[model samples]
Target chain A: DAGITQSPRHKVTETGTPVTLRCHQTENHRYMYWYRQDPGHGLRLIHYSYGVKDTDKGEVSDGYSVSRSKTEDFLLTLESATSSQTSVYFCAISRSGTTNNEQFFGPGTRLTVL
Target chain B: DQQVKQNSPSLSVQEGRISILNCDYTNSMFDYFLWYKKYPAEGPTFLISISSIKDKNEDGRFTVFLNKSAKHLSLHIVPSQPGDSAVYFCAALRAQPSRTGANNLFFGTGTRLTVIP
Candidate 1:
């Protein structure tokens, strides 16, 4: 409800191919994040960008890369897809500089790598 | 190692009854804690949060309690409803802001709450 949108609501791709997911926000929040959700792991942070051209790895950053060239968009890319990477990906945004800044999430993108 | 942990994988509660969800964390420096609820096929939504400075924070039918000494927290929903059925995640954030720290969050495995009518 925070004006966040994720492209390719659902995607199916084969292994050994490249995949990219897009997250767009209209709220103009200063912070954006990419996360993957698994059955037992819940939602694990993959990467986050605090500002344009500034990004950092999260707990489960392996095999994932992110780019934020503009304020409204953040992209997550998998160089070579694997079945293990199949999961629901979520994009979240938050306004920085506040003690209780809350993160808002998009509907989510379900990716299936076979 | 998981800094934040939610032991229960799923919980079932009867409609109109109180639902209690539990979470634990090992980090002492985490000053802020939050709870997010996610429905099937959707992303998580912010539920409620509590700061380390306070022992309890309440909003509507949802209440969050933080126990810094025990490194634990819990969420209570009064008269739970079927709409409240969803997977809930407990998250913690370090208060300090540094170059290495980007206000990123550490999350738990999440607890699935099912309110049965």
Candidate 2:
């Protein structure tokens, strides 16, 4: 509802293969984030970008990499996929990091690594 | 180490009854708290949020209570309906902006609420 969309809503791939998920937003928010949801772990932050070409790692940034070349597109790539990387990935955007830090999330990408 | 914790993994309540979901945090610097609801196959949607400055914040049937001294927070849904059944996640973030130029949120494991009709 926040003008966010994630491509490839679902995918299944074998281990050791390269995979990438894309998050696109139309709101032109200043912040973008990538998160993964797993059982018992909830949603863990993978990476986030505050502005174009500015990015940082999150709590669970291991085994993953992200790039933000433009304001609307953020990409999450798993160089060599592993079984542990399989999870529902979500992208979020917010106008700022002040008191009103409410983040709007995209539909999500369900990636399965065999 | 989990900074935020949601001890309950699941909860059940009859429709029209009040449903309470609890969350706890270990960090004292966390000044903001939020609740998110997620339905199956969909991304989480923001439900409510509270700042440490206040003990309670209410919006419609959803109310979030924060106990600073106890490092705890709870969400109350009054007159719950079947549509309320979903996975609820509690998240926390510090008020200050991180040096990395992004403020990240730590989330709880989530509680599945089943509102029986």
Candidate 3:
């Protein structure tokens, strides 16, 4: 609802292949994030960027990489797709990545790996 | 370790009643908490948030109460409507000011709330 859109709302890939998901926002927010949601696991942060060219890993960053070269876009890449990595990927943004900032999420991309 | 935990996997509430969802966090470094509502085919949306400085925060029919000593937080919704039925996720924000890293949110296994009319 925050002018955020995640491309390829649904995707199917095979194991060992690389997959990239795109998150685009018209909010022009300074902070962007990527998270994965799974059954029983809820949602876990994968990566976040405070600004363009500034990105860092999150708790589940082992198989993921991210890049943010602009304020409106953040991309999440799966280096090598695995069945265990299949999940619903969500992108979020906030005016500021501060403690009090509330995040707005995009319609998730459901990725399936076979 | 699961820093944030939601004990209840699901909760059933009746219409015109109050629905209370609870969450607990083990990390003391967390300073901000938020509740999000998600539907079947959509991403989680921001419902409300509370900072560590206050004990309670209210927005219309929704209220969030925080207890620092026990590291517990609860979200209260009055007059639960049928549309209120969805999965609720509680998250805690961890800030690291020393580094250029952005703050990250730790989430709990969401609780699915069903409102019966």
Best by DockQ: 2
Of the true contacts between chains A and B, what fraction does model 3 have? 0.78
Residue-by-residue lDDT tens digits, candidate 1, B40-99:
888899999998999999999999999899999999999899999999999988877547
Worst 10 residues of 1 chain A by lDDT: A94-103
Going through the candidates in order, what is the number of backbone clashes in each? 0, 0, 0
Ranking of candidates on TM-score, top first: 2, 1, 3
Full candidate order by lDDT, most accurate first: 2, 1, 3
* Highest lDDT scorer: 2
Model 3, TM vs. native: 0.96
Whichever of 2 and 3 has more lDDT, that candidate is: 2
Which stretches in model 1 have alpha-carbon errors above 4 Å?
none
DockQ of 1: 0.63
Q: What does candidate 3's lDDT look like per residue over A1-114, in tens digits?
A: 699999999999999999999999997888888999988888998998988888888879999999988888899999899999989999998777556778889999999999
Q: Quick one: best TM-score, which candidate?
A: 2
**Candidate 2 residue-wise lDDT, A4-72, digit = tens:** 999999999999999999999998888999999999899999999989889999989999999999999
